[model samples]
Target: MPSTDRRHDIDALRALAFALLILYHVGMYYVAAWPWHLKSAHPASWLQWPMLALNIWRMDLVFLLSGVAFALLARRAPPLRLLGRRAWRLLVPLVFGMWVVVAWQAYAEAVTRGAVAPGPGAFVLRYWAMGPWPEGAFSGSAFGITWNHLWYLPYLFAYTAAMCLLLPLWRHPAGQRLRAACCALRGWWMLLLPALPLAAYGLLLAPRFPATHDLLHDGYLHPLYFTVFAYGFLLGTDAGAWAELMRLRRRALVLALVALAAYMAARSLAPDWSEARQALRALYAWSALAAILGFGHRWLNRPWPWLAWANESVYPWYVLHQTLIVATAFMLAPLHLGPAAEPLLLLAATLLGCWLLTDGLIRRVPWLRPLFGLKFRRPATATPAPVRPAAEPIPR
Candidate 1:
C-alpha cells in the first residue's frame, strides 16, 4: 500500500520503536515489581522510571502505524481482499507462532519458576498435546496454548477486519467531517486531539477490565487501540494531517516532555489511579505518541537503504525477538554472570539468534517465510543494497 513515493519515516519509526521494544524487554527481565516469564536475580527499582516512559506508547505507535498501513492497502484492494491478505499475512504467523514458536517461551517460564519439572524438550510435546502444566507460570496459564508476546497480531487483525466492515462509512459525510476535523487539528489542539478516546477508555473501562492481552475479554484495550488505529487510518490518508503534524511537531515534543515530567511528579505523590490521575495518564500517553509521530514525519522522511530492510523485517523480528530474550536469559541466568554480564550476554544471544533465524533462514527459505509473516519470495540476497525497488512492495 505504500505508494511509489515511499515514507521512509514510517519505516524508520517502526524499526526504531521495535528496537526500543527489544531493549525494554531486556529491562523487563530485570525491572522491579513486575512479573514476567522470567525475572533477573537482581531486580533494579530504578528501571521502573525509564521503562514507564517507553511502556505507555510503544505498542500504541505500532497499532497507529499498522492503521496507516491499512489505509494504504485500502487504496489498493477492496476491504474484503485486504482483510484476506491480512489474515494470510498476520493470522498464519499468529497461529504458527502459538502452536510452534511461542511454546518455548511458555516452557522456559514454567521451568524457570519450578512450575514444571521437565525441560523444554519434553514439555514441548505435552504443550503441543494441550496439557495444562502445573503452577500456571506461563502466560495463558489456564489454557494449554498461549501466544505469549505475539498477542499483537490477533488484536491488529481483528481491528483491521472491523475497519473493513466499516469501509463504506470511511468516506461517508460524517466520516469525512471526522477526517477533516483531525486534519484541521493545529497547535495545542493537534497535540491533544487524539488523546480523548484513549483518555475516555482509561478513565472508564481500564479499571473494570485490566489488560490481560487475552484478545477475548480485554474491554479497555479495544476502545483505545481501535481508536488509535482509526486515528492512523484517517490521519495517514489525509495529506493535510501530515502538514498539521509537521507544523505542531516541536510543540508536541515540548508538551510530551512537560506532561511526562508532571506524570512522574504525580507518581511520586500517589501512584494509584484516580480520576485526575487517569486524565493525566491519558494526556501523558497521547502526548508521547504525538511526539513520536511529529518527529518521525519531520526528520525521518528520507529514504535509506538499511531502513527499507528493517521495515520489511519488522513483523518477523517482532514475532521472534521476545522468545529469544526469554530463552537467552533463561540460559544465561544460571551462569552467575551478574547484572552486567547476564543482560549483555542475553541481548547478544537474542540479536544473533534473531538475525540468523530471521534473515539467514526464514527470509531466504520460501516455504517457511509466510509462517513468520514474510513474503514468500524475496531477493535471495541479504537486504538489497539498492533501496528503491526494495521499498516498493513493502511500504515504509
Candidate 2:
C-alpha cells in the first residue's frame, strides 16, 4: 500500500520521462530527417543530427523507469496477481489501442499525401488486407498499421510476462546463487553482455533497420532492455545494493557526459561512418543508463508542482496522444506554418487535448474509465452523525 505521505519522486520521474517522449516526437516534426524516414519520403536533410542526438538516450530512460516501477509494484502485490493486472492494463491497450490508433495515423497520412481515404467499409477491407495501402505511388506497397509509438506495450508486456515466469525461480536459493555469479563478473564484462545482444540484434536488421522506436519489427532489442529492467528490479528490492552502486554517481555522470560529447563529435566529423558511429553511440547509451540510474538514486527526490498531476495524466496521454498529434500535424502542415510554429502547435495541442480528454471526459464516464486508466470508485455511503454538542450555554 502506498503511504499517505508517499515518496512521490519516483512517480514524478515516470511523468517526466513520459512527457519527454511527447516532446521528442513533436520535435521529430521539424527536426530534419527523423529516423523513421524511408528513402522514398524525400525527407529534409537538416533534421538528421537533431534526430540522432534526441533519439540516443530517450527510450532507455523510460525503460529504466518501467523496471523501477515493476520492482515497486512487486514489493507488496502477489507476483501472479500483479502480472495478471499488468496484462489487463498493458496488453489490452496494446491490442486495442494499436488496432484503433495506428489506423487513424495511417488514414491521416494517406489523406495528406493525396491517397484515397478509406471509409468504414473500405477500412475494414484494407485492414484485412496483407499490408497498408500502397506506400506513396512509387514505394510499391501500402503501409499498413505499423506499431507507431505503441510498440513499447507489447514489448513491455512480454518482458513482464518473462519476469512473472521467473519470479518464483528468482526467489529460490539456486537462482540467488546464479544471480550472484553473474554479478561477480567485472562491471566492464557485465556491460558486454547487453552490448553483444544489442549488436547481434542490430546487425541482423542492419541496412534494413532504422533505429527508431515506432518500428514494430525491430523489437529484438527489447530483451536487452528487459535485462536492464531486471537489474533495476534487483536494485530496488536489494536496498543497500543500489546505494553502493550509486556511490559512483559522479564518475558515471562524467563518463556519460564525455561519451555523449564523443558521440556528437564523431557524428559531426564522420557522418558517413555508420558502424563506428553506432558503436560510439552504444557506449554512450550504456553510460547514459548508468548516469540516469545513479542520478535517479541520488537526486530525483526533489518536489515539483506538476509531478503528481503529470503522473496521473501520463498514461492516458501516452495511449491517446498519437492520433491527436497526427491529426494536429496534418491540419497545420498545410497552413505553411514556419518550422518553429509546427512543432509548437503540435506539442501544445496534443498535450492539452490528451489531458482534457483524460481528466474531463474519461474520468467522468464510468464505461470509458478503463481506456484511460481511471480508478474505479465506490459510491459514498451514509455514516453515523457526530454526537450533538451539549447545551453548555444553558448549563452555564
Candidate 3:
C-alpha cells in the first residue's frame, strides 16, 4: 500500500484535458451561440476548429483518466475507504460549489438585469427542477447557464461507487475468471462487454431512461459512464501491458485517429443515418480507449515538475474556469474587442488568471490544499511519481 512514483505525465494530461475544456468554453462564447443561447446575427465562425478538435474526445479522456486514477486508488486503499474519499472529493464540491459558487454566478446575472435573485434554497430548487435536457432541463437548448457543468463530480462518484461495489469481484479468483471470460472474446473486440451495454442503453434506454449531464435530465448516463470507467480501471491496471502499448504509441495514435474520424463523420451525418452513427460511436469509444492506453503507455511515466503542479491545479481550475470564462467574456464584450482578438485573449487571460489565483490561495492557505488535491510544497522538495509496487499492478 505504499505510494510509488507519481505519474507526472498523467497529471499533465489531466491538466491538458481541463485546458481544452477552458478553450472550448471560451471559444463557444465568442463564436457559436450555445444551444441554449440565441443565435446572433454575427456568429464567431472560427470556433469550428477548436470545437471539432476537442469536443467529442474530452469527456472520454477525462473518464479514462478517472479510471486510471481509480486504479491508483484501488491499489492503495480498500473499497470503503476509497469510496469515502471519492465522495468527499466530489460531493463536497458539488454541494458547496452549486450552493455558493454557482449561486454567485446566478446572482451576478440577475442583479445586472434588475431581476429578483432567489434565496439559496430557492436557488437549489430552480437548478434541480430543470431536469438535464439542454432546453430548460431535458431539451437540448443551451441558452441559459445550467450551472450544472460540475455534473462530472456527481456522475463520476456514482460510477466510482458502482465500481467499488464490484471491487470484491475485481480482487478475487472470481474476478480473474470474469476477466478470463472477457479475454477469451478476442482482441479489442472484448470492448463490447462494456461498450455494447452502454450503446444499447444510449440507443434503447437513453431515450426513455436518458443519461444527461444536465442538472435536470437524469435517466441512465451515470451507469453507462460508470461502466466504461470500470473498464478503463481494469485495462489500465495491467501496467506492463500498458507500458507495451505505450511503446506502440504510433500505432495506437493512428488507430485512435482513424476511429475518431469515422466517429466524427458519422456524427455529422447521423441526422440522416442514426444506426450508422450509433455503431460508429461505439467503435469510436472503444478505439479511443485503446488509444488512451497506448498514449498513456508512452507518456504517463515521464516526470515533469510543472505537469505535476498543473495536474494538482486541474480540478480547482476546472471548478473555477467556467465562471471566469463568462466573467471575462462579459467584461471584454463591452470594449468591442474585435471578434478575432476576443476569444484568444479571453482564453489566455482565463488560464493565466485561474492558475495564478488558485496557486496563490493554495500557498497562502495550506489547509485548503486537499480541497484541490494539491499538496503544500516545501522549497527543495520535488514530487515523486505516484506509482505502485511490482506486486500490485493496479494503482487505484
Q: Tens digit of lDDT per residue, candidate 1, span 168-270?
A: 8977899778678777877788777677777788888988998989889999998888888988888776777787787777777788788788778777887
lDDT of each: 0.84, 0.65, 0.63
**Model 3 residue 329 lDDT?**
62
Any idea what lDDT model 3 has? Answer: 0.63
- Winner on lDDT (1 vs 2): 1
TM-score of 2: 0.80
Deviation of model 2 at 392, angstroms: 12
Best by TM-score: 1
**Reference-based TM-score of each model:** 0.92, 0.80, 0.77
Task: State in Å the error of residue 83, model 3.
Answer: 2.0
Lowest lDDT 10-residue stretch of candidate 3? 131-140
Q: Which ranking of candidates, highest TM-score first?
A: 1, 2, 3
Residue-wise C-alpha lDDT for candidate 2, range 248-344, written one tens digit per residue: 5667667667767887887788888777666666666766666666667566656567776776678878888877877688677657666566666
Provide the RMSD of all predictions against the true structure, rounded to 1 decimal: 5.8, 5.0, 8.4
Off by over 4 Å in 3: 1-5, 31-33, 36-42, 49-53, 108-147, 180-198, 206-211, 214-217, 264-270, 370-396
